[model samples]
Each structure stands twice: as structure tokens, then as C-alpha cells.
Target: MSHPIYLTKSDLKTARSCTTKLYYKKLGYPTVDRVDGYTRILADGNFIVSKIAHLLYPDGIYISANLKTEESLINAAQETIAYLQQDNVILFEPVLYHNHKLARADILVKQGDRTEIIEIRAKGFDSKAHEDLIRYRKLSYFRNKRTGKVGGEWRYIIEDVAYQVGILQEMLAQHLPDLQIEIAPYLLVPDRAKTTSIDNLASYFQIQRLSTHRNSFSKFNGIAVNFTGDVQEIEKDQFLTKVSIETEVAELIEPTLTSAQKYLDYLIEQSSEIFAPISKGCKSCEYRASDRDDRDGFRQCWGDLADVEPHVLDLYQMGRIGGHETPLVNEMILQGKASMFDVPLEVLDDDTYSYRQLIQIEYTQKNKEWVSEQLPTILKQIEYPIHFIDFETSRMVIPYRAGMQTYEQVAFQWSCHTIAEPEAPAIQTEWLDLENTFPNFQFAESLMEVLGDRGTILTWATHENSVLRDIYYQMQVYGYHNPQLQTWLANTAKLGTKGKSNLVDMNALTLKHYFHPLMKGRTSLKCVLPAIWKTNPYLHEIPDFQQYYREVDGEILSPYDVLPQLQIGDRIQVVNEGAGAMLAYQDLMFGENRNLGIDNQAMRSQWEELLYQYCRLDTMAMVIIWKHWQKLCAEVL
Candidate 1:
């Protein structure tokens, strides 16, 4: 006996993106998108947003479901149906199912013949800029007013609501044929226009991830929400806004239902006839295997074309070749031009090919690196006591304190490596704040002390300048009284004629003058580091730099590949990337809810140590790149 194949809202979204993925997903193919919804919610600070939403709508009949088993879903759907029978009621996560198609609304309200279907999203909405997005009489709320094309994210959101509304309509028709209903769709999103009047509102809600087996339905069994402080305090502020997308949902409901039905049919019959054409977008497909694996759906689609090394997709900003509206890669793919070697010489000869792109193509074909004649001249401009600095910051969906706007920048950690003179050992200095207080002012103040009013400050991208600039303006907004810090920020952070910003972007330097065959089309610090680290053998001999080098199975690894791991009870984790640092910061702040056996203070210290190593390596990586460039310039001289 076969159980009915229930189609979910997530399933519809996946199908809409790529029909081929539907086949890959249903058959349990390997994928890189292993981060579960629960984890994503915690990382984005949406868990707090959801809790606040629940608080806003205080009265509701909650339909509980772990969504781990079919039985649980059935019970939840049954419970929701029973609640909908009431004359006037509010239901949370109310499930509606008919014809093996189902959806669970974030919140549902029923009054007489009217029912409101609310979908909660973590995306930010600007009322002033996006007023026309949800205008009543439009074909879609998702269309960009200027472009006349449907916006990608907005389209996805509208379609998600439409998918749920279609199911609800079907369910009501089947279950309660005599009851007339008026369906209204609304999107509940964080409003940037509104401010929270309560301090530490984000601190109230905490996240807890439960332990689960590796082969379980989800990475964790489920996420548990815990409130640390009083809920009445949060009730005082209105931070979220609900906008009616009723007309947009009405226009999309039928189309979404049709597409969902086709996807459902493919799932039911286990069909492979659905053809999603290979294009530039296929490069980012999560279903594509990282290593040699059979379940590489991308390879399964592209076949021999996917095996092409230095592929056409490897060309630097290939999409920008024919312009963004219509990418040249799409044209190449249509003409069966897959390999990078197969690119027409006439195309490269064309004036549209950027000098960076030409360098990439030329050196990539020659199997060598290209050093611009101007690089040495640019390298000679820096003075002694050169500072290579890096920042680790996060923008939270909800602000930690009052008088702070939503998605405000929080600069929590910094690392600086200073060299007093040529050939001198780089001095390491860093600052990290784990205390339960606003850290931006302290962060800027400490950074100013280390940097002082001398030497050139070098950062990977415009990120450091941007972070400091944000802090500069935030100082004025928050009325932070710090004369030295303000003056330093004005000189180092502010751009244009208003201030003399000395911060130089190394990434910009790389873009204009540097090209490594190993780096392919990217100029990111991580990409450029490995390219130079592998090619330049002299770096391996430095005593201070030797810590990053290691041999495993007779193979030398990149410094990033050999990053230190921190053991948190049973789990061994590494914080190497910016996103990982953000999560670590969040854990330090709100991890009291998690039962890790270690006390709060111990956990804080461990997290701080882990973050310090990662950030220290970042500045260290920059220093390595600088040394490599100096050596190259010296050799040329």
C-alpha cells in the first residue's frame, strides 16, 4: 500500500527555481544545501522576529507539528481543520491539505466569511521606496517599477503566498462546500521605517538546536525557542508591519497552482522528462556535487560539457560580457560553447572584453601569472609601520537596544598586523567584545588606539572603510561623545570631499593590476591567497608564517584549509568565514538557552578564542599577500 505523496510549499518553490531539481530532490540526491531551515532562522535572527510576531498576535490556537513524520503532519492538518469550524478564531501554523497538496500559513484568522492568510518572512521591506510593490490593481506586486521585470526575491515571496492560498481554496471547497470564504493574503516582514522603543528586545528570544542522528530527516530534530526576559516589555514596541498582497496573490494563484500541479505529476510518476536548460545559473546549483560523486545532477544534465576545465563560466564576470539583461553565457550555451578554450577569439578581440578578462583569458591559456608593469610602482607608495587590518561585523535583523534602527551594523571584532619597517616582524594586536553591552563605540575606540595617527591602513575591500563610516554616522545618531574616535573615523572612514580617507582597498588593487591563473575570475582574498601561497615557495621558510603550513598525506594544504578547530563538547567546529563569525557572535550573546554543559562564562571564553584565531588569520593572510607582492616587485627591480 502506497501512502499519498503530499506536495509542500518548499517543494513548489524548488520546482519553480529549477524543474530538474525536483527530480534530484525527490530521489534523495546529494546536495551542498545541507543547512536546515532551523539553522538559517537562528543565523538570520528571524527566530526573534517570529517570537515577536507570536507576541503581537497574543490569542491563537496553535497547531503543533515537528514535521518529522507524516503522522504528525496529518494530525496537525486535522487539528487546523477542526479549529477552522469555529465562528471567530485565530490559528498559528494552520495546515490546509487537499489532493495531496498542502501548506501551513504562519498565522490564519477566521471571522464569519473572511479568512486572513499571513506569511512571515525575514526579508526587509521599505514602505517609502516600495510603496508601489503592493499596489491593489497590479498584475504582480513583484514587478520592479523601473525594469518592468519581476524582481527575483519579490517574485519568490509572492509565489509562496499564492501556492498556500491555492491549497487553502482547494481545501475549503472540499471540506466545507457550503461555507463561503473571502481569502486575503498578507506578508508580515520587518519594516525598516519603524523603530523599536524597547532596549535589548533581541536579547529576549533565544535559540536552541536539539541533537539528532546524521541520517535524520533534518540536521537537528528541531529548534526550540526560549524567552530570557519579560514579554510585556516587547509588547510596548511595534517593529513589524503587515502589508496586504491580496490582489497580487489573486493574479498568481491560478498560475502557481498550474505549475505546482505539473511538479506534483512529475513527483507522482517519478518522471525525468522535465527539461531545465543549462545556463549561467547552473554554476550556482546546490545539487551539483562538490567532489567526485554520482548524484551530481548538474553533471547529469551537462555531461561532457560539465567536465571542461577552465570552463566558459570561469571567465571573469562572464555575465557582464553581453550586459546583465541578456548574458553572453546563455548565448554560448545555446551555441554549444562550454569549454573556456572553445571561446571564439573574435569575442575576445571585441572591445567589450575588459582588460581584466583579457588577462584572465591570456594567462589562463598560457598557464602562467601576469604582473602588471604598474604594480611595482603602486607597491612603492606605502610608508613604514604598514597596518594590515580586518574587521568582523554583523547586521542583525533586529537591533539589540532602543534608539537603534532594524538591521543596524554591529562591529564586534577587529585584528591588526603592523610592520614598523621593511623586513621587520609583523606585530599582532586584536580586540573582541563578548560582554552584554553595545560594542560599536568601544570597538572603534580600541581600533583607533592600535592604528593611531600614522602609517597607511590597508583592508581587503571597501568593507573596513564602510564599517568605520557606518560607525561615524552611528556616533552622531547615538550621541556618542568621543572626540579622538570621531576625528580618526572622519580621516580614515569617510569618503569623497567631506573627509581625507587614507584606507586603501587591496581588492581594488588586485582588480586593476593583479591576475593569477590559479585565481580564475575571482579577486577575493581567499582566492588570491592560495594562488600566491602555492606558487611562491619563499613564504614557506618564514618562521612566523610556518604555523599556517602543514603536510597531511604528503600533500601541503592552504592556510585556510588548516584553520584551528574549537571543540564544544561533542562537536568540533571551525570559524573561518564571515558568516561563521556572525553565528559565533550570536552564540556568545544568546547561547544561555543552549545546554552545552559548560557554564556561560566558559562558553563565552571558548567562543572568543575561536573567533580570535579566525580573525587573526584574516589579517595574517593580508600580510602574506603584501609580502608576496613586495618580493615580486623587488625581483622586477
Candidate 2:
């Protein structure tokens, strides 16, 4: 059996992030967490963009056409060399191999003695805004920030391009000196500033997954790309330059190529399982997911390194405290002093919010939870008839309507739980639209209808505010004339114009006045809910919350953990997180959820019920959390 390709772009990025990841990744250890469908869709969307992007040149050769399997990468390299020998051929996914390392450039334009290297990325960057961010001191830069500047999240992307370029140049000098590698590394990203000439440009290319893999030339695994040009235009219009990668890498802002090569050389030298010291980056590590037999690679790696169950990496926002202006945690990591146990005593006592950080550390160490001293006083501000609203929405690559920009806001379903009084039955109302129609305006209208003029409209985070604000703009765009909507939206929604919002932010509320030991340091609703649910037994009896509580074999369960599975075509999909909900919406919208005549009405009914149950659980979760807070308040008051 041949060895799987270990050193790729992804591995290089991972190693750049933290050397430990390369070790774990190459070991074939499955991530404790599963990659969501939404992420998969996004990657494929980038793939589709690359395909259309190549059509812009219309001269690039696809070396990937026959290189389908692991074994085929070898053949692909040979094909790339053959194409390189030819006259000025544009190569899409141009294969470059150096020793065991391999790379496939998104687009390699080989023109006689000069070759241009282009990388197609889905990330968007406004050059003007980027410069502003740099000036505001909000962004830190390299030795030279003015010329060809790059900072913030683009650091990783720059490293990736640099690595690819370095590999190509080295390979060229050694293999094909005749091909003068005048490699001008450029990033072809979404030009948000440019408008597409064609209408519904996004919907033209439909991406469907095939159960079996297509040959190498296929766009992606299981995905069939059938593009229908101009969903709204009668004339054959193209968007080659109009929707091109508007933001190009500046000429002089390039980081040291030696820096990229150094990491690559180290990665090549390091064998499998290279253990690294803990760092702040471990907080968001994807490898945190456990594998077969409940073995967590993230925890195990950190545990062995620090010999502490909960380390400094778990400290809430450890890296953000000094802002981008300083690098305290980074300096510590460099000195091999980055760990929960190694956290400086002064570091925990310096900030205004240091009290909470100290409390978190204590509780984590003692294996207990901490509640704020002012929990009850803060909870007393609540009024009766609190409305808990939750929306499941999506921002698609393809616009649903003509003139709609890519990733236009679309709210598909919303659920609300009305608590008229302290003991009211916690009535539930919901609206879901999945038919072949835009649901944003209808969603807003239905939500407004359910929430009449009097009560504190509540939600877990600021996202709800942003959603309503987008809907307000959408209403104006669609020529929806309703003064009542304008009035209601202005008063309750976070208006971009007035910079005001009436909807109570529960996450902000939780952060200021509440902290459950179980919640660690994060304030997301899911984390907060689980942290409070099992602790309060009274909540387990409330009808709205009762269904979520059950002691099975002495183990407590979470409601979010037990949502039903959805049949999307032949595949069974579980709609659990926000990502899952988005994927589910896509499946339904694309007819993947519609079984062979599964009864139009019946299927719609099932979809409504499925969607409703998921959202109802969200609003109901708010109720349970509210009741739990009420109980905690009573204890303190």
C-alpha cells in the first residue's frame, strides 16, 4: 500500500498555526469534532469559483482531469511537467512535487520565459479598509506595513501563498531551468466592490454531491457542477472581470520567503507525532475533537505537555487582553511558558475584568462553578411576557433573486416563546417557509404579526439584531411598504441608521451578571444553557423544559444533543448547530430533502415540523434558562 499524501497546503497551514497539529494530523488521528456540511459547501463553492475563474483565461490546462486517486498524484506531476514544456499554457491546479512534498497551484500561467503564479481564494479583503485597520493600530504589521501591507487573518493566507510560491521556484530551478520562474504570486479573491453584469450569477452553478466519486477532472468529490448562465438575463452575459478577484496582493508587502521555507524544511524533517508546547491557539484547535474510544488528542497533548488538567490555554480571551499592540501570550509561548498553570499571577490581576478570570481559574482548578455576586439584582430588571425569538438563517453563495449580491441574508424559519406572565404556559409560535420562494420579507412579516406592541423582545446574542437589520434593508429593496414594520423594526431591531436596539441581548446579560462554572469562560447560549440546566431541578419539571431533562443510567442529557435526523436525499443529516441548520435549509431548497413524491403537502408538513421543533427548542431553551435564572435570583434575593 502506498503512503497517503501527508505534506499538503492544509498541513502546511496547520503546522504554521502550531507545530503540534502537523504531528497529530499526520498520525491519521480523526478530529474529535466532525467538519460540518456548511464548511464543506463553502470549500466546494471556492472550487466552483476556481472553475469559472479558469474560464476567464480560457487557456489554462487542467492537469487534475485524470489525477483522481492518491496514486494518481504521481501521474499528475508527470502531466504537469509535460504541460510546462509546451508553449505558454495556463495550468489550473498546476502540480509541483519536491521530494515527498507536493503542491497544486490554483492557476499557473506559464508564458515562455515568464510565469505568473495565481491563487484563487474565497476570502474577501477591501484594500481601503485594510489600510484603515492598519492605521488605527487595530492591526499589527510586519517590519514594513506601508508597502504591500498584510495583517489580521490574512497572515495565514499570505503564508500559504508564500509556501506554494517557494515550492514552485525551488522545483523550477532544479527541474526545468528553461522555464524562467518569473513567479509573480497573486491572490485572486472576491471583489466585493465589483458588481456582476449577469443577474442571479450565484444560482447558475448548482453544486450537487454524487454518492460515488467522479473521475479526477471532476470539480470536487461527489459534487456535480451544472452551471446555467444568467438566471435573469436573456442575453449571454459573462462576469469575467466584473466579479473577478478585485483585491490583489500589493507588490512590496511580501513577507520573507525564507520564513516560509524554514517552516517547510522543519515539517519535512519532523516525523509523525512531534509534540509541541501548549499555546493560546489551542483554545480554537479543530483537533480538540476526540476519536474512537473517546480519546481526545487535544486534551491528551496539552495534558502531557503541562501535566495540568485545565491549562492557561483555557483562559478566556487570553490573547486579546493586551490588544494587537502587545504580544504577552505570544512571548510566553515563545519562551515555553504558555500554559494555565504557568500564567503569571500579575496577568490575572491587571484587567478590570480580572476578577472573572481569577474566578474562572479557581473554579476550574477546584472543579466547581462560580456565580456572580450581583446575579439576583440584575435578573430583577426583567418584565413579564418576555418573548424569546430564534431564527435559522443562511447567506448563500448564489443569490436567490436577480440583482441579489452573493451571500444575501435569507431567514427561513423563526420560533418564538411568549411568557405573558411568570406562570403562563409559555406559548409557542413559529413560522417556516421552504417552498421555491424568498422567505426574508415573509419571515419578518410573520414575526412582527406574532410579536404585537408590548413586551421585551429577547434573544441570546447580537446576531438576531443584525438579522432584523438586514431584513429591514431587504424590505426597502423589495419595495415592501409597511410603516408598522418600519416602526416595529426601529424600536426593537438594531437599526443601522439610529444605532439603537430594543431587543435585550441575553449573552451580554449573562456576561455582565452571570457566570456558571460549567460554562468555562465562553458566553454562547449553548454553553450557558448546559451550564445552568442540570443544576436547577425545578426547570426539569417545566413542560417547555421537561422534555430535555432525563436521567438515563445516572447521566444527564442536553436537548441540543438529541435533535432528530433529517433524510437529505439518500443521506441522513443531523441538524444540530447553526451550520447544520444552514445545510438542512440548502438540502430542502435544492430538493435534496424531497423523496420520490414524498407527498408535496406531507413533505412540506414534515419539513415545517422538523424545522419548528429545532427552533422551538431554541426559544424554549431561553425559557428554561430564564426560569433557571429566576430560581438563582430567588436564592440570592
Candidate 3:
């Protein structure tokens, strides 16, 4: 069977990490359905900058298009060689091959006898780029077949050449075996400059002269080039200027396997070794779901590294243990000292209390002060005409409609509680209930009714506003005009300031404004809730709604049968019993739940009510937090 051709750096990285991931990639299964907005913007910026960098070498030939196929790549390389024979072509986006592996260079400068490779990176020069350049240089050297030849020279033209040289030198020392190479650094002509090279001129005094000389280029191997015109504007904006340099020695050889395939093989070979229970590589591993309970599997994979502190691994395990001990274990794990298995049972001398209880006691003692100080201030600023909103949405890979990039959030349900006045009773409002599969325009309209003419509409994050905007856009696209929805959106845009409806992110706020002892140095709502309020809504919440949805969708169980089996009372009991236990387990697994407090039954009851109340209080908390932040900003101004 023919092997799959995965040529990109991302593909190689994935293949090296997980064969299953590589297989999924080969099958055209998407690892990411859509890139984040910020990432998209960054990518676009990078492309634009890269194109501008190529304009530094205006006469450059574009040897290749961004091709996905191996055949296209080979054809491009042939074209690059052919173009090289004719003139001093500044080859843009050239695909070069070494040992059957392919790499695309942003700019390849063919000047007389010596070919200077110029690589353009969007980010400012950093150690990472230097390392990448070193690797690319090694690949180039090997592929270009210049290993045996001692006098061969290659030049690197980069954006920040001087800064990158140090990293390049270090890498070359480590990777290259006594190969004499000369590197000449070239700085880009600034936007205001007409002429380029400012070499050998005083940094302060040369500004005017450099600006004037920026457009003209010096003779290199008797060939003259111009550095002025915008490369992106040249040839209908098709080329980029980031080049990969290599020696001729590296070019002539052919490997039996492609870079992606070789990486995949490496992953499969090292699978057992890399999948260790240690948390070092666990944070981003694709195999995390499979290792949930596979202790032996963990031992086989990462047992040797068990002595090392497990961070995410400990957290994952603590989640499974369940209860008050969960936080305790989480704290211990976060401390980077002991794993749950290492904790001595004899340390918990209080026979009346379980080992879990001892851990909670320890955790509470550590983090209570921070939580106490911050919680009151966080709770004080909430005012009336408030809306408590929660959105249940799913992100799908692949843009479902035109003008939509990959991954759109489809809002399925929203639970809201509205209070008209601080003293008045709040009314519960909900939309798109899971109970009904049909479109609920009436539900949406009713929501709009309560949300009339606007007061502070509180949401946990900016997500609610996004969901509303998405729905509004969808409605407009489909020609379903509700004047009320449109008006609400327009008002929200004006007030929220760019679709960010007076929205507050509690997670971000907590990190910014508060800390908790029981929180065990973690800021997540799940962790914070138990620490501050002494209760967890998630604890013993049988068949969590999300999990239930997945199970139902998979046709593994009926919705009617699932909820009936998990009676609310039984679920509540599960929460009460499970809370302390998990917190205790967390203490053993991690170190201590820093936010836990002394077991005051009176305080516990109050805190329990507060925990449930706090879940309901989140939207209020967000509004309160936002108001406080605004006040703080005003005070600063």
C-alpha cells in the first residue's frame, strides 16, 4: 500500500506524537474544525507580512504554488531548477526536496554562483526560529548534497539576521560536524526607506542615508537587484519570502519514507514509552480519553516517571476518585510533590475521620484567607434589573454556511433567571429546551419579552452575546425577520461595544480579582465553587446533562430511562457524601485543597446554600465584578 504524503511541519509533529492521530489525519478527519478568530487574524497577518518580505527581492521567480499533492511538489521543484538556469530569479514559495522529504521556502535568491536563502517569519526573531533555521539548514545541507565538499558556502538573509545568528550558531555547532559556513545578515528596509543596506554606517547617523539607499541593492556575484517594490503587489500577490536553505548533499538522496510517514512510525514505536502516566506530556495528548482508568497501561507507558510529580495526570485521576477529597488530591497534585498512591494512610491518625477527611482539613487550613478576603468584595457590587444567563451550545467543525469560517456554535438551550429589582423575586426564563427538538421561535420571542429595552443582562462570558449575534445573523440570512430580535441586537452592539454585551467572564474575573484557599491555586468555577461556597453542583450530579446528551445521541440509552434512574434526591445524596470524599482524595493525590476550611456545620449549611445560590449568583457575580472593574478603571483614570 502507498503511504500517505503529509508534508507540513504540523503534520510531522502530529505523526511523531500519535499514530492514531496521523491515521485520522490521513483519513481526512479534522483535528480542528475551525481555527479561533485570534488565530485566523494572526495567520492572515503573517501571510501579509510574508508577502511584503518577499518584495525585498522583487525579481524573484515563484517556483511553486501551495500544493497539497506530492506530484505537484515535484513539478514545482523542477520548475524552480529550470527558472534558476535562466536569470537571477528571486524564487518565491519554492518547494525543494531532500531525501524524498519536501520543504517550501518563502524566498530563494539565486544570485550568480551563490544561492542565498532568505526565510521570513511573521513573529519577531526568537530562539525558536533560530532552532527551526538550524534544522532547515541541516535538512538543506543534507538534501543539497554539499556534505563531502569542504569549501561550500550558504548565506541566510532574514528579517532580524543579527539576533537569529546566535541561535543559528548554537544549532550549527550541535548539528553540523565541522562544516565552514558564512552567514550574512540583512535587515529589511523600513516602510519609509527608499534604499536598503545600512551596513557599516553609524546606527544613529545613518538613518537618512539608509532611508535614501533602501530601494537600491548592492552587487552580489556581479548581479544587481532592487529591494524597493512590494513583493505582494508583484504578480497579483502570489508569493511569500520565507526561504529554507540547505546544501546540495542533502538534496540528491532519497529516503524510503516521507517525513510524515517516518514520524508516524516513530510514534508507533515509542507509543508505550510516551504514553506514561506522568503529566509531563499528558496535557495535550490525544490518548488521554483511553488512559482514564488504565493504571497498568499508565505504568507500562509512564511508570518509570511516576516518581516525578504529575500535574494534569493527578487532576485527571482526582476527578475519578470523587468528593471533598477530590480538591485535596487536586491541591496535592498541583503542589508537585506526591501522587495519590504515595500518600501514607497512617498519617491520618483521626480514626473517626477517613483519610479523605484529614486531607480536606489540611487543604482548608492552607487557602481560606484568600477566598474570605476576595469573596465579599466580589459579591457586593451587584444591582437590580439583572439577568442570569447560561448557554448550552455545541461547536461543529467545518463552516456550515457561506461566509462562516470553520466551526460555528449552535445554541441549543439557555437557562436564565431575571430579577427586576434587588428586593423583588426573580423569574426563571429559558429558551430552546432540550425536551423539544423543534424550532422554538416562541421561546426566543418570550426571552426577548423579558429582555425588553435592556438593563444589565449578565452572562458568565461573552459567549452569550456571540450566540445571540449568530442567531440574529442566521435569522437574517434565512429571511426570518423578527423586528424585536433585530432591535435587541442593534442595542446590544451599541451598548456592549462590538458584540461584547456588557458580558463578563467569571473565570477571567476570578483570576483577576480573587483567590481561594480551597481552590488549591486553581481558578476554575468547579474548583472555586466548593472552596468559597463549600458546595459543588457537579458533585453527584448523576448523568450530567452534557454526558446524557452524548449517550442519547449515540443511541446507547433512552432519555426517559436515564433521568428516572438518577432520582434528584439520590443525586443530592451523592453530592453530599461524595463532596468530602473527593476533596480528601484530592489532598492525597495533589497536596492540599488550599481553599478548604474547618468543618463548621453551621457555616457548612450556610455555604451549601451559598454554593447553590452562588451558581444562581454567577450572573450577578459577573455584573458585580464588571461594575467593580469599571469603577477601578475610572478611579485610575
State which candidate has the highest TM-score.
Answer: 1
Using Cα atoms with residue i matched to residue i, what is each candidate's TM-score against the true structure? 0.91, 0.83, 0.37
- Tens digit per residue, CA lDDT, model 2, 511-619: 7777776787788878888777767677777666767776767767677876676664355645666776676666566534433274555555555566667788888
The TM-score measured for candidate 1 stands at 0.91
The residue-level lDDT of candidate 1 at 8 comes to 76
| Each prediction's whole-model lDDT (CA) | 0.78, 0.66, 0.41
Q: Report the Cα lDDT for residue 177, model 2.
A: 80
User: Of 1 and 2, which scores higher on TM-score?
Assistant: 1
The sequence of per-residue lDDT tens digits that candidate 3 reaches over residues 1-637 is: 1242433434444554554454444444433323433443334334434545654565766552535456665565566556655435676655554333445555556555445545554333223443453576643321224543312222212212322333233333544436344533332211211112222111111001111221011111122222333333343422222233233212211221343345545444444432223333433434322323332322333444444532324332233333454434444445554443444345444443343333433444453322224444544564567776765453322122323322334454455677677545456655442221223344456667777765666665466667776766667755777887777765663333444455445665565455444554355544554343333223223221222222335443322123222122112311222122222222211112212356533333333332233233333333333334444444434
Model 2 CA lDDT for position 97 = 64
Error of 3 at 284 (Å): 2.4
Error of 2 at 331 (Å): 10
Model 2 local distance difference test score: 0.66
Residue 470, model 2: Cα distance from true site in angstroms: 2.3
The reply for model 1, stretches above 4 Å from the true place, is: 1-4, 36-44, 66-75, 128-143, 147-152, 213-221, 290-294, 323-328, 331-337, 349-353, 496-500, 592-600
